[model samples]
Target: MSTSHDAALLKPGFTDAVFEAQAGFRALLDALAYAGRITTLEVSLDPPAPLDPATAAIALTLFDFDTKVWLDAPAAAGPVPAWIRFHCGSPIVSETHDAQFALVADARHLPGLGDFDIGEDRHPDRSSTLVIQVPALTGGSATRWTGPGINGSIEVAIAALPEGFWAQWDDNHALYPQGVDVLFVCGRQVIGLPRGVKVEV
Candidate 1:
């Protein structure tokens, strides 16, 4: 049996694979450097529905054959997994704990941070990175952000995250170098929230 998402195998990824992936990678780096600052993606893509250009761009730029990806319920039930598998050459894992990256198209249904690998002190870099799709990068309630890349602090109001997510984030941040990092995306805009960042409501 082939599968439902098999059709996604033909869905195109980056228009200019090498150039666009590099550009997208650079954009992500800048987003992380600024931590909560918006960095728009310049890549072109006809990504599967629910996977916006920014989210898809990050996947294409970061995922490789060795990376294992986990999708939220909505994404896994759609063509998202197949698209990632085909273009990124990443294995789609059923469990979040085993994934190097977790694409959360439906953050309202997001799992606890503990569900994914949070890495150990000795291997902090082994933690999972989450790409969460939010409604917008701004125009929601504001929360104060302060951390390594941030000189002072920035107020960010990312819309549509799951209930208790911020509280969960507090515990995650407490893990310091062992917590999962997050990238929030809306349309072509993305904002990185590394684990080292602190958020205050």
Candidate 2:
């Protein structure tokens, strides 16, 4: 890891310097408990270009030298990946499964979510986690969500989701604990849908 002044300054003071980052992490956890729910987090400064508020927030929270990232669109070669490298120090990988963090610049271009890692039988949590940066989400999607965090079902209108994504996710649910978790970033809002949650059309 580079320890130069610039790199050291890039290190998030949130773990020690700022309190808002910790708040964002907590809000993120709560949002994931209920699928498709939205939560807004406050950021002290604007993130680099091609980055939304939620994306910047997460880059600060989960990334480090230990993490590997995969980029879906905008090719991870320009300002997008460079920002991640400068701030997070996460390695970029060519393979999706090898990545601990995957950033999708445009949601429409996102691959079938199931094409990514779904974890494993022994250590299911090892699956790749995705960060999908979408254009806009008016009211989330009307995918009836039911599971641990919800009572009965909750309706949310998600942004543009890929074709047959639900069917593949249904298959993934069968795998139980061994599946991927996804985080959606739009502007400064975020929501998480872990594998444990069930989404029905």
Candidate 3:
């Protein structure tokens, strides 16, 4: 038998109901597309330090009984995971490849993007979606973003990203419909990096 979400996360006014959860998910989507932008979100949980607004927003939206989550560092233990389990009912997986969603607390701690599943050619959407919790996302980075959705190119600074993360991503792009998508969270904002996007770092 399984315990209900209501029974697990009983903290008054802390758990996000359905309506608020949708809003959080939307906010995350918008922020990722347009970098350096700060989007305000309604954070219901009182998560500990190092868990920024963007990361918290992501946890609330993506975590559910059907979702499998993986965490690195600071979030590997303590209040962050507990809050996620209590509110979203998402299961935690051991390997990055097995996760439906992977939340990396620190960019520096992130393993190679290829370490996680990039999905097969037929069903590329089955790959893991990475949620990177950045320190501060500001505009004016050297990295240029250009893909299907953007008009020309967009530039933004995603704090602490590894040197090769983008380069490897470019290589992955050649694989076409067989790469992982990504979401970058900072402060209370997020941005989407769909598999189709050609990331030129």
TM-score of each: 0.94, 0.86, 0.83
Which candidate tops lDDT?
Answer: 1
- Give lDDT tens digits, candidate 3, residues 1-201: 235764455333235467767888677666555543456676755455567765766777667799998888767865566666776788888798898898888888887878888988788888888888776666424667777657787775666787778787887777778877788777666667777777665
Per-candidate Cα lDDT values, in order, are 0.89, 0.74, 0.72
Least lDDT summed over 10 consecutive residues: which range in candidate 3? 7-16
Point out where model 1 deviates above 4 Å.
1-9
Angstrom error at residue 58, model 1: 0.8
Give candidate 2's whole-model lDDT. Answer: 0.74
Off by over 4 Å in 3: 1-16, 31-45
TM-score: model 2 vs. ground truth: 0.86
| Candidate closer to the true structure by lDDT (higher is better), 2 or 3 | 2
lDDT of 1 by residue, 135-173 (tens): 888887789999889989999999877778999999999
Better structure of 1 and 3 per lDDT: 1
lDDT for predicted candidate 1 compared with the true structure: 0.89
